[model samples]
Target: MMRYMMSLLAALMLWALPAIAQNSGPLRIEITEGVIEPMPYAVPDFVGESATATEMGRNLSRVIASDLSGTGLFREIPAQAHISRITSFESPVQYADWRAVKAQALITGAVSVDGSGRLVVKFRIYDVFAGQELGNGLQFVGTQDGWRRIAHKVADQVYARITGEGGYFDSRVVYVAESGPKDQRAKRLAIMDYDGANVQYLTDSSSLVLAPRFSPSGDRVLYTSYETGFPRIYVLDVASVGRRVLPTMDGTMSFAPRFAPDGRTVVYSLTQGGNTDLYRMDIGSGASTRLTNAPSIETAPSYSPDGRQIVFESDRSGTPQLYIMAAGGGEARRISFGQGRYGTPVWSPRGDLIAFTKQSKGRFHIGVMRTDGSEERLLTASFLDEGPTWAPNGRVIMFTRETQGAQGQARLYSVDISGRNLKQVQTNGGASDPSWGPLQN
Candidate 1:
């Protein structure tokens, strides 16, 4: 009887531990589905101590303001129109001056050097219209070189508090960088800060590569390459640049690889004969199992955040559409009923929606829909906008956009889910097939 009672106690503890873990983290607001107008905000130059500190403060504030404004959710008031300059960091803000400039929200801060030589920053977000502090003021301490990260964190906090959605500005993206002409393009894997800073190439552009994806831990990337003269999946260690070709069936093309949420298995498309189907391979032992047996093209498999199901693109219905199947493989059900073809479906990390590239009316668009195919919303329309990759927080999407002209160009761009804040992301050359990495350490 005592053993049975102890067993019951253990079971109860196991269940209760998950609930405790879930409640112990920082609070996050859920952004609802709908359209809302952007809020007007004013972020003036933060007060600083030395000349270098002043310049750093202004640069950080400018970057933060740009980041917020580019989300299409906040409008930054021009500094020239400011009625008053922030002279003192500790003094109370003159609400009348902010109101006079038609600013609805205000952000102010101060930067100084701590005794230990680290940079100290204190910032606050204020609801000018509501005449109240939105949240507690926050402080960050880091080296001077980390000013951009500090600014991003500050912007993230402010964005989260105001919009109720998780912030994604403090993130990075890893993608295939393309250069040279269209016919003989030289492509190399690269990574950069989320805002297109600190670009670094990972590969030497000696082989053809496509569709790079970040592992769940963001420490490595899984992609397809033709290094051996045949399409094969390769895993790359981001830190050491180590490479490993995943072992699979000889002569079979394994492409469109994505790491399972557990980061131990990979789901990809394996082409046999003329048919492409989905399969999962264990990373450690290279043991493989077929997930889809249908003769249709099943590719671009993305695991649901919970790892229970996968959303992929299939042409079984005579036209390409989105479908969901169990991770262990089962009968797949189509979830897209829109007017045109959809491909490259990616499950959002938040598990709320799936983003895809839609080809309709002779034009392509980047759009998102609920997991069950409901509430389809197009976030971008263009001659060609493909490869919708979600930000770490899932509030924003980065995709490739191409324009036709005398000098046609392909560049990276990001947009909010509401079809707002269409801004170009700078790259060294033509960029496509952008995949955003998870938040870094």
Candidate 2:
């Protein structure tokens, strides 16, 4: 009897945790499915104690402002419009000066370098209209080489304090970098910061690679390669760039690999005997399990945040559509009933929506729908827009967009879930098949 009571109590606590975790403060920004006006904010250059620190401070402030304003949720007021200049970290904010410029929120920061050359960053967020600090000030310590990362951390905290949601600035994206003409393009695996900075190539353009998926912990990547004359799955460590092909049956081919939420297993499409189906693999033992035995092709499996269920694209009903099934794969249910053919479905990290690429009439689109296939909304339409990947916070999506022409090239683009702030992601060369990783620790 005591054990039963304890179990019930624990279940109740788990149900109540999400409500308790939400912020119910005066400075919170409530986000709904409708259009929202961007919040106006200001970020002055941070104060620094020395010459090198000053340079770091200026760049850090610029990057932080860019990170916040790029979201389309917050608008940055130019430094020239500010009436007050922050000269010290210990000084109090001039709320009246900020309010004069109609800045609803203000961010102030400072940078310092220690004797060991470690960079110290400190920041605070203020509710200018309320005339109070939104949250407690925080500090981060890192090396000079990681100044941009430190800037992202500061911006994330400021965003969280004002918006009452998790921030996604401190994250990275793994993608396939492309070059040359459209027909004879060269593809390679590359990783970069979320805003298309700090690009590092994992594999050269000597071989073709596609559909790079980040591990749950962001330490590894799974992708399909055609180096062995046929498509196969390979896992690469993000830190060392070391890679190894996952073993399969002597004649079978595997592709479209995605990691299960547990990170120890992978779900992918396998082809054998002219039949394509989904399969799960235990990476530790290299053992394989057939998840689907249907005659139709099943591919692009993505695990839910809890790992209990999987969402994938299938062609069982004569046309490509979206389906959901148990993680262990027994029975499945169709979730999409729309005018268009859907494929490449990816489950959002928040688990509230599933993003997919759709084809209708004569155009391609990137769209999102609820788990039950309701509230389906198309976010983009392009000549060739596919492979939608959600940001860490699930508020934005990045995908590949290719222009229409013989000389067309593929580039990366991002858009808000509401279909606002559509812009191109700057890369040194053509980029596509972006996989957004989790935020850094």
The per-prediction CA RMSD against the true structure, in angstroms, equals 9.8, 7.1
> Candidate 2: deviation at residue 31, Å?
3.0
**Can you give the TM-score per candidate against the true fold?**
0.88, 0.94
TM-score of 1: 0.88
Model 2, 207-242: lDDT tens per residue?
Answer: 899999999899999999999989999999999999
For all candidates in order, the CA lDDT equals 0.83, 0.88
lDDT (Cα, tens digit) per residue for candidate 1, span 1-441: 111112211211211232221222232222323234456689999889888789888998998998888776567899999997886788888888888887777899999988888999999888775566777899999998888989988998888786555678778788889887776888889988899988888888999988999898888899889999989999999899999999988878999999998999999999989999999999999999999998789999999999999999999999999999999999898999999999999998889889999999999999988899988888888899999899988877899998886466789998866576678998889888888987656
**Residue pairs in collision within model 1:** none
Measured with C-alpha atoms, the lDDT of residue 307 in candidate 1 is: 98
Error of 1 at 253 (Å): 1.3
In order, how many clashes per candidate? Answer: 0, 0
